[model samples]
Target: MFEQKATEWVNSYSDMLYRYALPRVSDSDVAKDLVQETFLAAWRNIKTFKGEISEKNWLFTILKNKIIDHYRKAVNRLTDSFPGMADDDPYFEEGGHWAKETQPKEWGVDYNNPIEAKEFYEVLEKCKSKLKEMQNAVFTMKYMEGMESEEICKELNITPSNYWVLLHRAKVQLRACLEKNWFVK
Candidate 1:
């Protein structure tokens, strides 16, 4: 009986689930795996699904948690030995202060306005994609998902020091990329 209902979910929700997972995981194979795992988990807990929410929303909620788990595992597996910047880090001077020549230029942004330039988010995503795996995961977890520092540290199996370093480096790289692609140009 439940088997039949689960099968119906595959037919009804797999594509939508895949679409949702792909952009978040940024990989087709991982997205497919997540969708399959979602269904399997749903099957195991099928008795607990009380239909308070629509089946689609229930499945989607399960899949979202699965995706977060996938990222957590991937981040745990990654080494925290971030690469050096090869001495061209424009944001800092020799003494670690903001470089006068490289201070961020003011943008003509309207803070009072509700909307921003659409291209800003596009460029930000592009910048995010260029980050290293661990940096990307940490950045997304902290800023995008609004996870706490301790939660991120625990999820990634990283020390607090390591988490701060990754966040700093991700910010530096993202700022440089956005300035080059969006602000400076």
Candidate 2:
């Protein structure tokens, strides 16, 4: 019975899980693998299914953890490459304000307009792809997944200060990329 139910979940939830994972991981193969892993994990832990939550929700939760694990591995790899790299505040001044030259320019985008908003998002995705692995992971977790700072720090095994630095640098790099690619164009 558990095997049948798990198989049914694959047929029902695979596409949804794939869609959820793809944008987060930005790789079709990785997304598919995560979905497969999620199902495998659900099947192995079938005895734990107490029905407090729907099977779909439980599967999604498992997939989310898989995605977090993916990000954690990527972050670890990056840190391993550049051990003890300093997180310098290059974009801020002594008073913690944006440095004169680094002040953000107005985007003047009409987000309410679907066409413009869509174009902006396309540009944003391109910019996001340009970020370093760790910065991208941190930014996506906080802004895209809506994960809290504490949760992200805990999951990523990063200090709170490190999380803030990564988020800040990601935003700074993204802003610059958008300005050059979107605003200038």
Candidate 3:
């Protein structure tokens, strides 16, 4: 009976989980592995399943944790220092404003238009891929997952200041990438 139910869950939730994880991890194979891992975990803990939430939500919660774990592991494997985190950031000036040449330009795209938005997202993903691993994780957790600063700090095992610095660097890099690739083009 438990095996049957587990199969049912795999059939039902695998696609949704894959879609949820793909953009976050930015890799199809890793996303599939995470989904498989989520199912394996849910199966192992089947005895603890309660009716407090829908089965789908529970599976999603598991998948979300799996994604967070992926980020945590990637962060732990970092060997090189992030030069973008240095105190003398290139994007900002002495007074913490955008440097004269670094000021943002008008995107001039209709965000509500689905076609343009999709194209913009494709470009954004390319830009995101260029960010350092820690910056990508922090940026995704804070902006994509809408997680709080404290929660992100706890999850990534970084100090609050470090979290802020990573977030700032990610934004600066993303903005510059977009400006050059999307806005100017």
Candidate 4:
């Protein structure tokens, strides 16, 4: 009976679960792991499954919690295992962090700038391609995906300050990268 219910749930939920998990985790492997863990958790807690929440909702809730828990555990392990790693160390920090605390150019954004959308997107792509792996990852999670720093830290197994520093460095690198790659012509 447990196997039957589990199979049925997997058949219906596999693709749906993947869709929900993929964008957040980015890697196909981790998304699959999350989905599998969600199921294992659900199977173990089947007796406690309350009818109040829809199965889909419950599964998703379980998956999200699992994701957060995964990050938390991973972060705790890393932090607990390592010590005296100064965040001030320049190794992880990248370009243009100085501008983050300031206002954008006083010239201001002109959304009506007549540039073609394609050209704009190409420029963005070019800039993104030049970013360091970590910079690009943080930028995607924060900007493209619209996640807040707190959530991103929780998900990526980083601290709030690390998130801010990453965001700052990403913006800086993006600026210099764009200027060098796109605007310097």
Best by TM-score: 3
lDDT of each candidate versus the true structure: 0.78, 0.82, 0.85, 0.67
Model 3 segments more than 4 A misplaced: 1-4, 79-84, 87-102, 110-116
What TM-score does each of the candidates earn? 0.73, 0.77, 0.82, 0.55
lDDT of 4 by residue, 67-117 (tens): 656545544566343232235533232562544423233333365775566
- Number of the predicted model whose lDDT against the real structure is largest: 3
Please report, as a residue range, the 10-residue window in candidate 2 with the lowest summed lDDT. 79-88
Please, what are the lDDT tens digits per residue for candidate 3 over residues 1-185?
86787678878888988988887887789999999999889888877988799889998999999999999998677666553466787788999999888888887877676545688788888898788778888989999999999999999888888888899899988989989887886
Question: How many backbone overlaps does candidate 3 show?
Answer: 0
Candidate 4: pairs in clash: none
Residue pairs in clash, model 2: none
Please state the error at residue 146 of candidate 3 in Å.
1.7
* C-alpha lDDT (0 to 100) for residue 92 of candidate 4: 35
Decreasing lDDT order of the candidates: 3, 2, 1, 4
Checking candidate 3 for backbone clashes, the offending pairs are: none
How many residue pairs of model 1 clash at the backbone? 0
Q: Which ranges of candidate 2 are over 4 A from the true structure?
A: 1-7, 78-103, 111-119
After aligning candidate 2 to the native by TM-score, how far in Å is the CA of 101 from where it should be?
8.9
TM value for model 4: 0.55
